[model samples]
Structures are given as C-alpha cells and as structure tokens.
Target: MSKSNDAISQLTEKLPILLIEDDITIRRFVEINLKRSGFQVMAADSGETGLSLMENRRPALVVLDVMLPGIDGYQVCSQIRDRFPEVAVLMLTALSQDLDKVMGFEFGADDYLVKPFNPLELVARIRAILRRFNKDSGSLLCSGSFRCDLRAQQLFMDEREIELTPQEFRLIKVFLEHRGQALSRDDLLNLAWGEDFVGDPKTVDVHVRRLREKIGNAPSTGRIETVWGSGYRWREGS
Candidate 1:
C-alpha cells in the first residue's frame, strides 16, 4: 500500500469503538473480541450511559444493541446521528427481519448485524465502516455560501452553522461532489449509504428532503431540484 493508505489505515485502527449492550455476557464477549481485533473498546450497559459517554469521550464508531433500558438502540442511534454525525453506528438486533434492519438504517445506523453473529464478522464490519468513513477526513467542500467541513462533520451557510444528521451529511456531501448532475435514488443510495445498505430505495428521498430543508431553498444556498423522471440534482449556479 502507499504511504497515504498506510496512514489512513493506522488512523482507522486508532479511533475507539463504543459498545452499548445491556446484556453483561454479550457486552463482555463483544468487548473482548473487539480488543482482540486490536480496537480500543468502551463498553456501556445502557443507552443513557452510552449517550453520556458519547459526550465525555466520543468514539469513532458505536456498536449499539437493539434492546436497551431508557431509550433503546433506535433512539440512541438517532441521538448519535444528530449529536455526532461523524461517529459511525453499527446496530446489533436480534430481529433478522428486513423491516428491523431497514428501521435501524432509517434511524441512522451505518450497518446492522443480527444477533448470534460471528465475532469475526462483527469485527470485519466495524473495520470496513471505519475505513470507509476515514477515507476523506479533514477535507472541506465549499460551494457559494455553503461550506462543508468533513473534519468536524459540520455544515455552514453564510457562516452560520447548520445541524445535520449523519445520513443528511453523507447525502449533502455526495450532492456537493456531483453538483448539477441528476443522480437517481439508487445512485444516491450507493454513493451515500454504500452498496451494502439494505433499505428501501425511497429512503434516499426522505434524506434528500431533510438535507434540502436544512440547507434551505434560498438561492444563496443553491437548490436541490427534482427532475420529472430522474431523482434529484444539486443545482449549481442557481
């Protein structure tokens, strides 16, 4: 590998992984496996505790369990997405149904694994997500009055910071990268959510709508135009 790739790989391994599992057995088991895989682990037994730790020591990725006390994984995942858009979320759900997986994604989970999964597979998934997210760290994308700081995972409109969820941040980044190009829902899902995402194609529409709302319809912020047959376009020179 090249020097840059080696640096990113080292960086990916250095960021801590937060594990939020209410079950003691599972938490300890997963924590051990994560440490064995060369990752630093921070284990929380409750969603509230996990959220609290997030504030104190933000991890690069979170391994969240579906069933938890006082918030549940979905709610915690939503909070993480809203509060720490840079942190990737990997949900562990006992439910293997498609609906359950899709629900996790809607709540901003980067990926989901059914319960009784192999420890190696879990570690692999976590590694994959970290590597993908770490690809462009500290880069900035600017257009007109908008400035996107990938380093801080922040967006600024006319120098005013605008809040965005994790999904919205990814979507906006893709749109900014492909400004003026009509990108289909599938195109967006693949680009923003990755090819492994197992959710409805229309999920792209929901996220795009939210992103548009955050960026606003003001001409200064540019516009997300909906084509008749195509999906949407981040219209440039608007």
Candidate 2:
C-alpha cells in the first residue's frame, strides 16, 4: 500500500470505495485523486483481486476499469450486481463508444466514464452518485401502494422496493413532477438526458417501457398514460 492509500484509509473512515484497474500509473493517479476527494480507496490490480476484496470489504461504491487482466469489467460488474445489489458500480475505461456504454449499463454499472478523464470531474460524478443513492435509501413518497422517494431515487409498490436505473429515475421524476400533464418526447429528452444530449426520442420510449415494467404491475388504471400522437403523462390517481 502507498502512503496515499494509508491517508485515504484513515480519512475516509465511512466512505469506503473499491478501485479496480490494471494500469499502475492510472491506479496511482486515481488513488491519489480519490484520497484528496475524501474517499477511502482500496485498489486491486486485477478483476480476481477486486472480487476477493469485494467479498470481504463490501465497499459503498466501485470504480472499475473495463479492460482488466482477468475476467474483465463487465463480468466483475455482473457478479457484483447479482451478489450485492445495493453496492454501486461506476465503469471507468478508455472505451467511449455508445455500444461500450450501453454494454456497461447492461452489465449493471451505475455510471460510465471514458478515460483520460478529468480528476476533478471524476470526484464530482462520484459525489453526485453517492448523494443520490444515500438520499433514495432514507426517504420515500407514497400515493396509495405506489411510492417514489426522490432522495433514494427508488419506487415501490405495496411496500415492495423496485430497482430503477438513473435514467428511469429521471424520467419518473419528470412525470411525477408534472402529473396529469402531457409531456412530449423532446421535453423528456431535455429533462432526463439534458438539452445537450444528442439522442433519438426513442431512447425515452425505451426507458419508459423499462420503468413501466418495474412500477406498473397492477392491471388497468396504469400510472403512466400514453397519448396517441403526443408523448406521455403520469395519471394523477391510478
């Protein structure tokens, strides 16, 4: 362990993080940066070591590199998601293609970052994810058996918790905030993915379908209403 790791271990008493990357230079750079940003960082040089640490320490979040020596980041992320669903995984890699990002999400990564990344920006992203996860876990909003707590970024039905991706959470929030009002696909694109994001409206439709599958279990009187020609709306009472 390096001196920075020692400092991080002491300073980040409650903010445990697992960093899995094969590059020594990059790992050192990230470890130092994370320590400066107030995160207790545990590093692994390979996916196998990362998994062993994960089984033992169970960090609050994982910063994983997709191109690892053994097993690969996707396999590691899938294993983590299957075994420890609450732990958040953020994929940090050199692969920046849209397909790579989609693959990371499919493998259960919470966020994806292309490498040669800015150190300060990485810190900021980590903070935002942690803040969202912490907030969602502690509070919930209820309307009948359906519940959504913006803090936890979670939804529930009949007291049963539902898992939602970050994109799904943003979409649901937009609908809930403007309940009963029709929102166009463009409106959702701006709200969920930001005005600068260049993606087709069909992305919103795909996310909505996933959200409905998770939260729309009851038959009829659905929570989300689809308009024939326009967009969609959240029903006030359904």
Error of 2 at 201 (Å): 8.5
**Residue-wise C-alpha lDDT for candidate 1, range 56-165, written one tens digit per residue:** 99899999999998889999998998788778899999997777877887787777889899998898778767766765567998887888898887889889998876
Clashing pairs in 2: 135-151, 135-152, 136-151, 136-152
Alpha-carbon RMSD of each model: 2.9, 6.5
**Worst window of 10 by summed lDDT in candidate 1:** 196-205
lDDT of each: 0.83, 0.76
Give the TM-score (vs. native) of candidate 1: 0.82
Over the stretch 95-145, how does candidate 2's per-residue lDDT look in tens digits?
767777777766767676888989987876676566545433355555546
